[model samples]
Target: MFNSIGIPGLIIILVIILILFGPSKLPKLGRSIGESMKNFKDSTKDIMDDDEINQDEKATKENK
Candidate 1:
Protein backbone atom coordinates (compact mmCIF):
# COMPACT_ATOMS: atom_id res chain seq x y z
CA MET A 1 0.00 0.00 0.00
CA PHE A 2 2.92 2.37 0.56
CA ASN A 3 3.88 3.93 -2.74
CA SER A 4 7.38 5.36 -2.83
CA ILE A 5 7.66 9.12 -2.29
CA GLY A 6 9.13 11.26 -5.08
CA ILE A 7 12.18 13.40 -4.31
CA PRO A 8 10.18 16.64 -4.16
CA GLY A 9 7.54 15.17 -1.89
CA LEU A 10 10.20 13.83 0.44
CA ILE A 11 11.87 17.23 0.63
CA ILE A 12 8.59 18.99 1.34
CA ILE A 13 7.73 16.64 4.16
CA LEU A 14 11.17 17.03 5.71
CA VAL A 15 10.95 20.82 5.39
CA ILE A 16 7.55 20.90 7.04
CA ILE A 17 8.82 18.78 9.91
CA LEU A 18 11.90 20.97 10.35
CA ILE A 19 9.69 24.03 10.43
CA LEU A 20 7.35 22.47 12.96
CA PHE A 21 9.59 20.65 15.44
CA GLY A 22 13.00 21.98 14.38
CA PRO A 23 16.13 19.79 14.13
CA SER A 24 16.80 19.48 17.87
CA LYS A 25 13.86 17.34 18.86
CA LEU A 26 13.83 15.38 15.59
CA PRO A 27 16.76 13.10 16.48
CA LYS A 28 15.35 12.38 19.92
CA LEU A 29 11.95 11.61 18.42
CA GLY A 30 13.50 9.32 15.81
CA ARG A 31 15.61 7.50 18.41
CA SER A 32 12.63 6.81 20.68
CA ILE A 33 10.55 5.58 17.74
CA GLY A 34 13.36 3.29 16.56
CA GLU A 35 13.82 1.84 20.03
CA SER A 36 10.08 1.26 20.42
CA MET A 37 9.93 -0.61 17.12
CA LYS A 38 12.99 -2.70 18.02
CA ASN A 39 11.47 -3.70 21.36
CA PHE A 40 8.23 -4.70 19.65
CA LYS A 41 10.15 -6.90 17.20
CA ASP A 42 12.08 -8.58 20.01
CA SER A 43 8.94 -9.37 21.97
CA THR A 44 7.26 -10.89 18.92
CA LYS A 45 10.31 -13.10 18.32
CA ASP A 46 10.24 -14.29 21.93
CA ILE A 47 6.56 -15.25 21.59
CA MET A 48 7.25 -17.23 18.39
CA ASP A 49 10.14 -19.06 20.05
CA ASP A 50 7.96 -20.00 23.02
CA ASP A 51 5.29 -21.38 20.69
CA GLU A 52 7.88 -23.52 18.90
CA ILE A 53 9.17 -24.95 22.19
CA ASN A 54 5.62 -25.81 23.32
CA GLN A 55 4.90 -27.59 20.02
CA ASP A 56 8.10 -29.59 20.27
CA GLU A 57 7.21 -30.76 23.80
CA LYS A 58 3.74 -31.84 22.68
CA ALA A 59 5.18 -33.81 19.75
CA THR A 60 7.62 -35.56 22.06
CA LYS A 61 4.86 -36.57 24.47
CA GLU A 62 2.71 -37.96 21.64
CA ASN A 63 5.59 -40.08 20.37
CA LYS A 64 5.92 -41.92 23.75
Candidate 2:
Protein backbone atom coordinates (compact mmCIF):
# COMPACT_ATOMS: atom_id res chain seq x y z
CA MET A 1 0.00 0.00 0.00
CA PHE A 2 2.76 2.46 0.89
CA ASN A 3 4.72 1.69 -2.25
CA SER A 4 1.79 2.86 -4.33
CA ILE A 5 2.63 6.48 -3.46
CA GLY A 6 4.62 7.63 -6.49
CA ILE A 7 6.01 10.93 -7.73
CA PRO A 8 2.61 12.63 -7.89
CA GLY A 9 1.80 11.72 -4.33
CA LEU A 10 5.21 12.95 -3.23
CA ILE A 11 4.78 16.22 -5.09
CA ILE A 12 1.39 16.75 -3.50
CA ILE A 13 2.81 16.14 -0.06
CA LEU A 14 5.70 18.48 -0.71
CA VAL A 15 3.36 21.21 -1.88
CA ILE A 16 1.19 20.82 1.21
CA ILE A 17 4.14 20.99 3.56
CA LEU A 18 5.48 24.04 1.73
CA ILE A 19 2.13 25.79 1.96
CA LEU A 20 1.68 24.93 5.63
CA PHE A 21 5.21 25.75 6.76
CA GLY A 22 6.32 28.18 4.01
CA PRO A 23 9.74 28.26 2.43
CA SER A 24 11.39 30.29 5.20
CA LYS A 25 10.30 27.85 7.89
CA LEU A 26 11.10 24.68 5.90
CA PRO A 27 14.78 24.49 6.80
CA LYS A 28 14.07 25.17 10.46
CA LEU A 29 11.37 22.51 10.43
CA GLY A 30 13.73 20.05 8.76
CA ARG A 31 16.39 20.65 11.38
CA SER A 32 13.88 20.23 14.20
CA ILE A 33 12.67 16.96 12.70
CA GLY A 34 16.23 15.74 12.29
CA GLU A 35 17.06 16.56 15.90
CA SER A 36 13.88 14.91 17.14
CA MET A 37 14.64 11.76 15.15
CA LYS A 38 18.24 11.72 16.37
CA ASN A 39 17.15 12.08 19.99
CA PHE A 40 14.53 9.39 19.63
CA LYS A 41 17.05 7.02 18.06
CA ASP A 42 19.67 7.81 20.69
CA SER A 43 17.23 7.19 23.56
CA THR A 44 16.02 3.98 21.94
CA LYS A 45 19.59 2.75 21.51
CA ASP A 46 20.33 3.49 25.16
CA ILE A 47 17.31 1.50 26.33
CA MET A 48 18.12 -1.39 24.01
CA ASP A 49 21.75 -1.43 25.18
CA ASP A 50 20.57 -1.82 28.77
CA ASP A 51 19.17 -5.23 27.80
CA GLU A 52 22.82 -6.30 27.29
CA ILE A 53 22.30 -9.20 24.92
CA ASN A 54 25.21 -11.35 23.70
CA GLN A 55 25.47 -11.75 19.92
CA ASP A 56 26.91 -15.31 20.15
CA GLU A 57 24.14 -16.52 22.51
CA LYS A 58 21.46 -15.00 20.32
CA ALA A 59 22.93 -16.67 17.22
CA THR A 60 23.01 -20.08 18.97
CA LYS A 61 19.42 -19.70 20.07
CA GLU A 62 18.38 -18.75 16.56
CA ASN A 63 20.20 -21.79 15.18
CA LYS A 64 18.22 -24.07 17.51
* Best by the lDDT measure: 1
lDDT of each: 0.93, 0.91
What digit string (tens of lDDT, one per residue) describes model 1 on residues 8-60? 88899889989998899999989999999999999999999999999999999
TM-score of each model, in listed order: 0.79, 0.76
Return the top candidate by TM-score. 1
Error of 1 at 62 (Å): 1.6
Q: Model 2, 22-55: lDDT tens per residue?
A: 9999999999999999999999998778665666
C-alpha-based local distance difference test score of model 1: 0.93
Q: lDDT of model 2 at residue 42?
A: 99
